[model samples]
Target: MNRLSRVSIAAFALAAGAALTGCVVAPVGPYYGEPVVTAPPPPQVEAVPVAPYPGWLWIGGYWTWQANRHVWVGGHWAAPRPGWRYVPHRWDPGPRGWREAPGRWERR
Candidate 1:
């Protein structure tokens, strides 16, 4: 092939490969609408002890999916971030299954 034809073919192949890979890798977070049928067990109430240090916030415990079952993760103290509040993780029931919303820091 001529130089121009070879370059054009290479560029087209690269673009096509990127497009296909993007579709396969696009969903990075928890898979929604996955069939679970049964809801995860209720979260266990963990006693929030006194903060170990000043400006520490108590993040509550939550149930996490593991080995097709719900597992309890204990709560712990986290250093407070300026102008931000920590939101605790939670599992919400949906028609198909429970969706886990991970905890994150949000600006006040």
Candidate 2:
């Protein structure tokens, strides 16, 4: 077989193996929803307390938009999810205005 044919066969084999494995890779990005009229206040400096239980993770405090204003949510300890990671709530300044994203657990 020619070099081009060998390369094409190798690529096909790799693709087939990946398909059989059912593995998929995709780019994850923040979801931009409606813009808030005002920006959120700066995050508070939190002194994370010790975990009440072993293997627990600290979820930091963040500013949340509520009732047309910013509200401070205290930090707390949460039991770790087996195959997921915690996403802290945050606000991002977009072209239109500040956008708020709520905390969530996403697959690792």
lDDT of each: 0.78, 0.84
TM-score of each: 0.63, 0.65
- Model 2 misplacement above 4 A: 1-32
Per-residue lDDT of model 2, residues 2-107, tens digit only: 9999999999999999888977786764344668768887789998887899999999988776656678999999999999999888887998888888889999
> Model 2 lDDT vs. the true structure?
0.84
How big is the positional error of residue 26 in model 1, measured in Å on the Cα after superposition? 20
Question: Model 2, residue 69: what's the lDDT?
Answer: 69
lDDT of 2 at 6: 100
TM-score of model number 1: 0.63
Query: Quick one: best lDDT, which candidate?
Result: 2
Per-residue C-alpha lDDT of model 1 across residues 1-108, encoded as one tens digit per residue: 799999999999999998888564443543534545567677787778999999898888887765666678898999989999888787677776667777889999
